[model samples]
Target: MKYPILCCISLLGSLTAFTSSATTCPEILSSKQRLLNSTENIELCEAFQGKTLLVVNTASQCGYTSQFEELEELYQTYKDKGFTVIGFPSNDFRQDRGSEEQSAKVCYLDYGVTFPMMARSSLTGSSANPVFTQIQSQAGVKPKWNFYKFLINKQGKVVATFPSSTSPVSSTLKNAIEQQL
Candidate 1:
């Protein structure tokens, strides 16, 4: 039988070492350095190593800001399951707090975002940052809106696309993460 796109990887305690443990940001950045956790320009393709990365283009003013609660829930639930949620604050939709510090602060204070959050960045189309563009090129998917979620499996492949309206706690998203785990 055909397995789900995420079934190729299983839930586990740590990131997969075999495929990505030693990878460096410089290496990935030969292509593009992804802004990581407020300041560092990271090599996203390698940083998570064998982990499933839930990449979302976030906006503070968007209606879906409430999804932050569920996002934290999912992170708490699966972080030990070898998954991570990467929040990339974006004003590409003109919905964010308008500054890197403001956006980052909002995510931390209001949403209780403990996950890695990049400084505000663009999500898609022409101005796509390296991380966003790389994922689309590698995963063969594109962002649909401000809150689009890209469920990437251990191998850095985009397993599924959860549209902006899909709650972070939705079963459809959870199922994909579970399958990867």
Candidate 2:
């Protein structure tokens, strides 16, 4: 009887260890992405796991370009609470200046955006980046214009989407983000 009890305890310990070591990557964050103006790439799940994300498709020359300031403010406010904003420069609407360097300059030097900005990528049609593809599939919507935002919960689920016309400082957007956090 004593030997049987010891064997059962050992099996339970092994199961616990296996369970703890097996961390599953969420589907939405399972792809790799390169940062703006850099050759380095990072897995989204590895970098952003368990954090609420506000993913935006940006264009430097658009009428809504000034929204970057408001977006930065939103990021600064909730960043400490496990929230982050990610920008993806896209020329799907012919608004970008068409170079990674220019995009980087617009984001870093011009707007002072500290959040992660990805390299220029297609945001619509068959050439969309993997991340945007996932977002579209999960949220059932694609960005119709630059500055379109998708709010994702900590679980990697999209909770809300804001059009390019929606200000980052709008009460509706803020409330949605607060709920997720």
Candidate 3:
């Protein structure tokens, strides 16, 4: 009886310590977003806290849609080094496919994207989602077109913003990611 009680107490203390050290959601990543083609939603900070992130606003029919391949390659290259790429499909520029299924198919099957691609959402102006709104506030700019990217450090700071024309594998973006890692 004494041994069991001691073990229980020890376990309780361990759980307390673990909870205390867990990362809290920063204001920028505080919103919950649904994953593409899934009913499930993930709290951004819970999924990405302490990770270097490249957040991209994507569109299925844009000229820059091919950037998904390069983005995936970039993700695979440095994903193990505390880095991640998060894609958010948006239609604010009026280039997305007709529906969520089409968008998910483009991301998951057509592009073979293995990174996290969120469900379609508004990505510009007053209707922008919480994450992008916060990003614009911090970065001083918002997505002017599809495939715009924002690099965020582990501390949730927006380190850099790249326009639609900047390739994911471009030296400037890669160097910034490397520095953050």
User: lDDT for each of the candidates?
Assistant: 0.74, 0.91, 0.92
lDDT of 2 by residue, 18-59 (tens): 776446667888888999999999889888989999999999
TM-score of 1: 0.77
Q: Rank the candidates by lDDT, best first.
A: 3, 2, 1
Please say which candidate is ahead in TM-score: 1 or 2.
Answer: 2
Worst lDDT run of 10 residues, candidate 3, spans 18-27
Candidate number achieving the greatest lDDT relative to the actual structure: 3
Q: In angstroms, give how far residue 163 of model 1 lies from its true place.
A: 0.5
- Per model, state how many residue pairs clash: 3, 0, 0
- Candidate number with the higher TM-score (1 or 3): 3
Q: State the lDDT of candidate 1 residue by residue for 3-73, as single tens digits.
A: 65446555332456543445533221234344533446665554576788798888888888778778889
- Worst 10-residue lDDT window, candidate 2: 18-27
Report model 3's TM-score to 2 decimal places: 0.88
Off by over 4 Å in 3: 1-23
Pairs clashing within candidate 3: none
Tell me the TM-score of each prediction against the true structure: 0.77, 0.88, 0.88
